[model samples]
Target: MNSFEQLKEEAVRLDAADTLAPMRGEYLFPQHDGKDVLYFTGNSLGLQPKGVKQALLQECDDWARFGVEGHMLAERPWLSYHEQFAAPSARLVGALPHEVVVMNQLTVNLHLLLTTFYRPAGKRNKILFEQKPFPSDQYAFESHAQLHGLDPAEVLVELPYSEGRTYHTTEDIERAIEGMGDELALVCFGGVNYFTGQLFDMQRITAAAHAVGAYAGFDLAHAAGNALLHLHDWKVDFACWCSYKYLNSGPGGVSGIYIYEEHTRNASLPRLAGWWGHDKASRFQMKNGFVPIPTAESWQLSNAPIMSMAVHRVALDLFDRVGMAALRAKSEQLTDFLQRVLMTVRTETGWALEVLTPSDPAARGCQLSVVLPGKDRSFVKVLAEAGVVVDWREPNVIRLAPVPMYNRFMDVLELGQLLARFAE
Candidate 1:
């Protein structure tokens, strides 16, 4: 008989009208008792598609029946296995198939790209990244700098937040690039911040980095499969992402990397090579010298891990079938619905909710970082106990993402009602 009940009822009505609601059946949602938990933590680890197990089993069958012959004789053809995935994966990330390669984990690909693009020199040895980057990226950059005999403390620059704000503005990021232009070697940041869920201005950041002659890269662990991207058109020098998050390929799955066609063919760029990067023509010729392939495939260092690639291939195929445009349309609607109801709760309860993600749909993905004013971490615990799954960062921040394909408008409504109760 309260506003919370009214909101829940409205959400149920909206769910009945949602066209993408059926897509929820496509995933293997975790359940408690006899009901589906209102899951909103896909930004951390996405729920698996029902078909993934079948796809993975096919690969296992191929290996069992054919053994070593699976390389050329398997149904999916393990010899050129990654090729099967390249096109759809590239399509999802807005790159040409030749410009994208499925390779090692996210951090490893980052290290490899750093080898090629983080070309440090006398005055230009400094690397720039946003403040509060995910810990993995910070470690990769720091170690890469150390490998080049530079102190990360001195050579790595972390851009601070804007005036009276928790998130950095485009102008602030661009200004930092300009100030450090002369000394900047690489400009890199998360496409969508892991904790704050703030999506940076990739196009503007790329242009600004190039304006100062610095190479631009993105650690897209949180962005890939969560939002649409155009790395090739954006002229991003390199980018990397994990498959486990938005991509939903299971834990520690093979990650992907993008090196625009220009860099793919850049003969002068330094790379750490292995046999997998060797020319296919001479690959089996037992050649000694490394003759790199001309595409992003040349960046690969080892044979593709079949299990990881199988999972990603299935996930990518699903994305291809659904298509980014359709997914993004649903994403905007879902997140907009979440933002609206949460804002209403804040207004009614006199609770201050800080949304750190950009207001512009163009600048954010599915996530909205909700910073609860003067609330303890226990507040998040209460929501979790109420069967809501939102990620909590230290110091009173909760991140909720209503994934486009699987989350329902009703799920968003239910979470808001629970938070309103906790606020009381």
Candidate 2:
């Protein structure tokens, strides 16, 4: 068994050899008592990239120099600002550039996309989702059901976990969709379970949803920048995500959506329209006819927000530099290192905190959900006092995400020690 010191030394060696280790400096860290805080809450909100300040300053300078003409003259023109995210965000999500567009916040985009995808008429009008989806999604789905004058109870299929299982299985979701059959109009899920930190099999789930002729979409709030996605290949009908979390775009940053390129050609699909979403060529003509753009840009209701999107542009550029596959490799290694350290600490000291994230690395992302059941909830406070930043969920779960982009093997090592000491 590796002693705590041995684990620290191992971490040092591993990080020293890691090609992605230099990325830790790309993000700004908070210091507590003149020490770099052991931050593990990237799943909730990532540390800002050090380059974000420069990106924001450039936006300010461009506006100052060009005034209203900045739309055409700025470094990244304000008018086409959202377009800049298409390629990088597409790479991050494993989507086609034309299929992705950066736009409104999470729930707002969810509502907009649902309006296009969720059409409940006659017997074919039920939507399937997790029993415990994010609150916003629950409201959005329920409201979508009600909007068509359909009963939420009759039109919603709430898939529950098996009594003994920690999370939903692929078979469980497939069975639900098959059971619902033609009545299911849409199948949506949080791409990753928020509280449990479980990454769902989007490909399998989407295929299953398609088998039943139901539209497959995901609220990728937790999964977007955290997992390696292939939305286009997976045949996901639609999906949306907020960039503020693992994407490190700052709080309340701009969000993006993926609509399969095939669907973009359907000009008959109903969408809420605005001046910005109108065709760029005829848009300035202020004509009455709504000419839809042949891309995900058609779904956008407003122009991009420059300052916030400027921050996102820099962050996405980082993902482009290091690439998601390399990041996923490092994420798996870091989480494995943390889990092993926790297990070793348990073996040596008998600390019984449970790891709720799946042991199979393929089934999870960067976050590891840990629980000290029946212990004082004040454990989170103790961790915070010790400069360990983590997310606390209801009842008693500490969500620690050792993000590969900025988190080191050393961060998880320190966290393991803090957890062991906290248990004592």
Task: Tell me each candidate's TM-score.
Answer: 0.96, 0.97
Evaluate residue 291 in candidate 2 and report its C-alpha lDDT on the 0 to 100 scale.
91
Per-residue lDDT over 258-358 for candidate 2, one digit per residue giving the tens place of the 0 to 100 score = 99889987989988998887888888998898999989998888878899899998899999999999999999999999888888778777877788888
Per-residue lDDT of 233 in model 1: 91
Clashes (N, CA, C under 3 Å) per candidate: 0, 0
lDDT of 1 by residue, 132-187 (tens): 99988899889989999989999988888866777888999999999997899999
- Per TM-score, the best of the predicted structures is 2
Candidate 1 lDDT for residue 395: 82
List the candidate 2 regions with Cα displacement exceeding 4 Å: none
As a TM-score, model 1 comes out at 0.96
